[model samples]
Target: MAKWTTENPAFVDTWFSLFRLGQTKKQFNAADTIKMSELTFFNPLSSKDNLKIEATLIADTIDKVFSSWGAKLENSISRNTAINDMIQILLDEDKTIKDLAEKNDENYFFTNEIKLENES
Candidate 1:
């Protein structure tokens, strides 16, 4: 099994720390800002199934870590864009859809009338 081992785990931790700072009116550091920006640009692709699974697991891990602090893993685009470009790419690239459905429960249609709601 693949694992997520970052060069700087503190960088990932600092990104989550921003949510707390935002809630408490504390100032976020410059490094935190840069790390968050770097994380936003990740777009991995692979031909091997194992690599794809590993990548999806990593993305899911990041999404979960941020979500614990009330931050959502949204696309790097304005909400008013013509298409949800990042989400489409994620789906096409075999990234897990469960995270997206969990975050956007209101938008997921399970049946003609019943939308699958996330209990989270």
Candidate 2:
């Protein structure tokens, strides 16, 4: 099985923490200060089935979070440029997508829609 892990787990946690804070404030204190590396995702895609599991896991997380807070979230992740870029980062790479399509020990994918919905 593949797992989604980040070298900077604290960064990820803090990022989400800010998001929650923004939710309370009705606006992010420093929107422009937030960032994620193009290569933020760290995982070993050992097989297509495993990768699918990872993607599905990501999707499920989003579904659970967004479904609960859909109104507050307003569901803007799909239209986000960062999300699109992350998808591209997954799809544009023949190696990554192919590995994701089947399975490669070294593949990375970032799901923006999957990322946001779960944060709520």
Highest-lDDT candidate: 1
Clashing pairs in 1: none
Q: How much is the lDDT of residue 97 in candidate 2?
A: 24
lDDT of 1 by residue, 70-113 (tens): 54323443332212422343334333222232323222222212
Per-model TM-score versus the true fold: 0.27, 0.29
- Best-matching candidate per TM-score: 2
Each candidate's lDDT (Cα)?
Answer: 0.33, 0.32
Candidate 2, which ten residues in sequence have the lowest lDDT sum?
A: 98-107
Candidate 2 wrongly placed segments (more than 4 Å): 1-42, 72-120
List the pairs of residues colliding in candidate 2. Answer: 45-104, 47-103, 48-102, 48-103, 62-118, 66-117
Per-residue error (Å), model 2, residue 106: 30
- Model 1 scores what on Cα lDDT? 0.33
